[model samples]
Target: MLGGAGVLLGVAAAPAQAAEVSYATECIPPAAAGLDPVQGTTKVEVTAPATAKVGDEVEVVWKFVQAASKNPDLIDLPANSVQPSGTLKAAGAQSGDIAMQGPRENPAIAKGGAMVLSDMKGKLKLTTPGEVTLTPDAYAINVMSTDTKCSPKETVKSAATINVTAGDGGSPPASPDPTEGTSPPPTSGEPSPSESESGSAGGGGGSDTGGSGGGGGQTDFTGKEVAIPYACKTPIGDKNATSPVQINAKKDGGSYDLTVQFKGSVMDSPADIPADSVKPSMEVVLGGADKGKVHVEGPTNSEAIKSGDPMEIPDLTGTYKPGADGKSTLSPGVLTVKALGTTTTCTPTKSAVSLTLDTAAQEGGAAGGSAGGAGVSGSGAGGSGGGLADTGADDGGMLKALGLVAGTAVLLGGAVFTFMPRRHASRKAP
Candidate 1:
C-alpha cells in the first residue's frame, strides 16, 4: 500500500494537513460464500492539502491505523495476496466519489492471524473552488480471488475538509487541446506536400504500424506520438516516467474490442529482475457519455533483465461494452507493474484521452463496469486470466517434487493412525 502512496506523492507539490478518525465498519462476504456479515472498528488517518487552487492536482492519503484481521473462515493467506480499495465521498465544493487503491502488501499469514493491508491513496483535480468535505465511504477487501465489501455501520461524522481557491490565470493547461493542429491533412487526387510530410513523420514515429481499417470498421492509432506522464515506483525508489501508447478500438456487436500497446521503457534497476516475474495491468477511465472504468492486462516479460538494464513491457487488451448511448472518451489511469515479488503501481499525472467513439445504448446490463467509484479502479495483481509465473524450475520437476511430498505425508498419516483407537457406535434408548 505504501507503493501506492509513493505514486500519489509525485503529483503533490506542497505539504498537507491530516486528520484521524475511527468508525465501525460492517463487511459482507461474497454471495457465493454464503457467510454472515462481520463488524469491526477501524481507524484511518486522512492526509490532504488544506488549500488548493482550481485545476491543481492534489493527493489524498488514507493510512490504516492497524492491520486487518483475517476472515471468519480462517484461511491461510500467502504473501502479496491481499489488496484493499475504497471510495472517498466529497461534498460542498466538489461533489463526487474518488476511488483509491493500494498495492498488495503482507507477509505470509497463518490461519486466524492478522492480515497486513496497505494504505490507500488517490489524486483528485480541483474543479471548483470552495470548502469540500471528504467522508470515508464503502470499501472492499480482496483476498486471493474472493472479495469482501465493507461499509460504515453508522453515519460517519469525522472527516477531512479542504478549502479550494481559484487558480492563477497564467497556470498552464493540464492537457493538450484536442482540436489543436493534430489532425492529418485531407487527401486529394494527388498527395499534397504537407500531407506527404505528415505521413512520413507518422511512419517513423515508433513500432506501431500507422494505419486505420480493421475488420468491423475498426480505427487504429498506430504510430501516434502520445507521451503519457506516469508516477512510477521502481526497485530503487519512486520515479516519474513517460512512455508512448497505441490504442485501437472496433465495435463488436453491442460491445467494443480495445487493444492497447505500451511501448516498454528501459529503467535503471538496483537489483536484477528475474524472468517472467513482471506483470502489468492497466485501468482505463471512461468519460463523456459513459462514466466508469475498464480493466486491461498485459503479458509478462519472457526473459530475465539484469540490473541497470532496460525492461520491456508487453501490450494490453480488454473488452468493454457501453452502458449508455452517445460519444465516449477513453483515458489512461493507473498502471500496476509487479516484479520480483514486489508490487509497484503508477498513475498518470495529467489527462490524456486515448480514443473517443460513439455508440448506441445496450439493451441488457453492461458487461464491464468500473471496479471502484471514480478515478482509476482497483484491481488485483493478476486480474482475469493473468497471474504470477512459476519460476526457477520446470513444470515436470515441480510436479514430481509435489508428488513426493504428498506421498511422504500420506505414509506419516497412516503410521500415526495405526495406533489410534476407533470410536464405537452409540446405542439408542427405547
Candidate 2:
C-alpha cells in the first residue's frame, strides 16, 4: 500500500503562501453506524442544512469514530483513514491532510475497546439546482498479520443528501398585459429581454454559451489550476511490487484533460501459472466537476505477466471545475485481480494526494489573457504535465491458502473414497 508521506512528494512544490486562502468544502451527509472491516464499530455523521440556494455558502461538518478491540499494541492513526465521497467537492484545505487524528492512543477503549474519533469542517455552495447527495464511502483500515502488513480492506459506511434550490435569477418575470399600453412579450420559448441582454454580455467578452439563460453567463473558472499529488498502492496481482503514478492534465474547453497512467507488474509466487489467467485492474477517483471512478485494466488483451513490462492503463479525458473549497483531490481507488480462479482485493498504501491552487498565477491569467488549450487532447507518452509518475502495497494471503487447502482436500478425498472403494466391495462382506 502507498504511504501518505510518499504520496505527498509527487505533488508540485507550492509557491509562497498568501495571507488568506479562499476555501470551500464539498457538500456531503454523514454516515450511519456500521462494522469496520478491520475490527470495530464505525460510525460517521455529517451535519448540514437539508436545503440551500445556488449561491448560498453552506457549512458541512463531519465526525468519524471507529471502535476496535483493545489490544495492548499501539497503532498509528494514519493507517486508519477515512475520506468523503459522492457528489461533494472540496476546494481549500489539503484533502490528504484531512482525516481522523490521535497518534497512537485509542481514545474510545475505555468506553468500549479501541476507538478513534475524527471531526472536520468544510464549506460548499451549489452551482446548479438539484438534489445533491454526498456519502462517505472511503474507509481504508485493514487487519494486520503477526508477521506481515496485509492489504487494507476498504468499505463504505453511510450517506446523506441535500436539495439545492434554484438561483435567484433562474426564472423570468411575468409578461405584462398588452392592454395596459405595454408591448407584447416574445414567444413562450424565446429568451426574455433580461436574458437577451445577459447573452450579449457573455458572447462579447466571455466564453459563456449564449443559450445559457440565467445569471448573465457562468463566471469563467478556467484560470484555476493545481498540480495534484497521487500514489499507487496496489499494482494488479502483486501486493509487494511497486506501482507508479503519472498524471498529465491541461485545461480544455470548460473542462480539464486528465490522463492518469499506472505503471506496475503482477509478481506472485508460483510463476509457472498461465499468464492469461492473470487479470489485474485498478482505478482512479477524481473530484471536481468530473467526479467518478475511472477503471483501468492491466496490460490490454490477455497478455502474460512480465516484470519488465509495466501495466499502462488508458487515459481519462473530461472537464474539471473547482469545488466549493476551490481545490481538488485525486485519490487511489480499489485494486483487484483474478489468478488461478481466485480473486484477491488490495488497497493502496496511502490515503490521498492533494492539489492546492496557485492563486497568483490564476489572477495573472484572469487579468486579460484567456487560458490556453481549449478542446486539447491528451498527447500520449510525453507531453506537458507528463513528468509526474512514481510509485509503490500488500494483500492478505487468505485466497492462496484457501485455494491450496481446497486442492489438498480434493486429493485426500480421492485417495480415501475413490481408491478405497474396493475394500467395501459390491460382493458384500467379502
Candidate 3:
C-alpha cells in the first residue's frame, strides 16, 4: 500500500509555490447501482487533454466487484468486464493534453464478492509527448466501458479531466475511497496466528519488516503457528498503480490442511471484472498478446489434520522484474503471476481424506491438488496447471496489440493495425 509519506515526499520535492496542477479520470459511472457485475469494460479520457508533462503521471487500477444484489437481470448484464483489452486512444484535442511517453501501465486484482467491487484505476505518466510543448491544454479525457447489454457509462465518479501544472515534475493523487477512513469489518474464518518475524513490522506502523510471501512458515503443535504475509503483484508493463494481495492460513501439529488465504480489492463498481481483465490474484490466467497464457490454482492441503505440525502450502511464484540497478525492484510493471495452483476438492470419509489438482487436459496430464508451483509453466516440482513457478514470470512475448489484416494478396503484404484497451493501470491512488 502507498502511504501518506509518499505524497509528502512528492510535495516536499516540489518547488515552493509550484505550478497549479490537478487530475481526474473517467474511471467510474453514474448509475452503477443494482448491477450484479457479469462483465464490463473501462477506457480513459482526459479533460483539456494534451500530452502530459514529465514528473506527472496518470495512474489507473482496475478490478472486479460484486453487487449486493446479484439479480439475474443484474448478473446477466455482463457480470463485470475484465479482460485487459482496453485502450487509451488518442482524440483530436485529447491526444496532446496528456503526456504519453513511457506510459507505464499497472494492473492489479482484488476479490470482491456479491458484496464487493473493483474500481477503475490508471495513471497517465504526465511526460513529454512528441511535437508538444509544455503548457496547460484541454483534452476530452473520456473513459468508456461497453459490451452487449453491458453498462454504457464510463465516468464512475465524474470530473474526468484535471489540470496539472507540468514541467514541474508534479503528479496528482488517486481518487480516494470514501470508506478508507473507516475500520474494515473482520472476516468469519479464524485467521492463522501471527508469527514473530526475525525482523518484523506491519499494519499502520508507517513501516513493517517485508517478509517472504505466500506459504512459508513454521507450524508446531501451537494451533496455527504459520503467519504468511498477504502480498500481491501486478502484471509487467504496469507503472505500479495497484497490487494483488493474498493471505494464507496453516494449523500446526495437524493433518496437512494447507489453507492459503488471499484478499481482493474493493472497487467502485462490479461490472468491470470480466471485460477489463482485472483479477484478485497477481497471476494472469487468460491469454494475452504480450503476456501469453497462464494456468492458475488455489492453495490447498491434500491431507486432513492428524498431529500438531504446520503444513506447507505451495508458494506463489512468478517472475520478479528488477529495477535498472540489476537488483529486484518492487514495482507494478516488473511483476507477473506466471502460474496459479489448482484446487482439488476430494470427499472426506471418516478419518481419511484425499486431494488432487484439477488439471487442464489441454495443457496435458494434470491431477487434482491444491497449491501451485513457483514456475512459469505452473507445474511446480510435480508440473502443470496452476500458478507459482520455480523461476520468476517469464517474458513470453505476451504483450502486443490486436489487429485485423486483409485477405488474398495481403499475406504478409500489407499490415493493418487494430487497437483495443488491454492493460489495467497499476498506479496507486496518491
Find the candidate with the highest lDDT and give its number. Answer: 1
For 190-215, candidate 2 gives per-residue lDDT tens digits of: 11111111000001111211111112
Residue-level error in angstroms, candidate 2, position 146: 20
What TM-score would you give candidate 3 relative to the actual structure?
0.20
The lDDT, on a scale of 0 to 1, for candidate 2 is 0.29
RMSD of each: 26.1, 30.8, 23.2
List the candidate 1 regions with Cα displacement exceeding 4 Å: 1-14, 67-73, 170-430
The reply for model 2, stretches above 4 Å from the true place, is 1-242, 250-252, 255-257, 263-276, 287-299, 302-325, 354-430
Q: Rank the candidates by TM-score, best first.
A: 1, 2, 3
- Please provide TM-scores, in order, for all candidate models, with all chains considered together: 0.38, 0.25, 0.20
The candidate 1 region of ten consecutive residues with least summed lDDT is: 191-200
RMSD after Cα superposition, model 3: 23.2
Judged by TM-score, which candidate is best?
Answer: 1
Tens-place lDDT per residue, model 1, 1-430, is: 9999986764454568888877877666444332345556667788888877676767788787743233222233445555678877777866767777776665655443545677888777777778877778777765433456778877886468788766656543455232222122211111111011101111122232223332345433222334455554432234444445445565667676666654323233222334565566778777666777777776665665443354434556676677677766666668776543445566766655656666556654242455422122122121112221222222221111101111111111111111111121121101
The runs of at least 3 residues in candidate 3 whose Cα sits more than 4 Å from the true structure, single-residue gaps closed, are 1-236, 241-248, 252-256, 262-264, 275-430
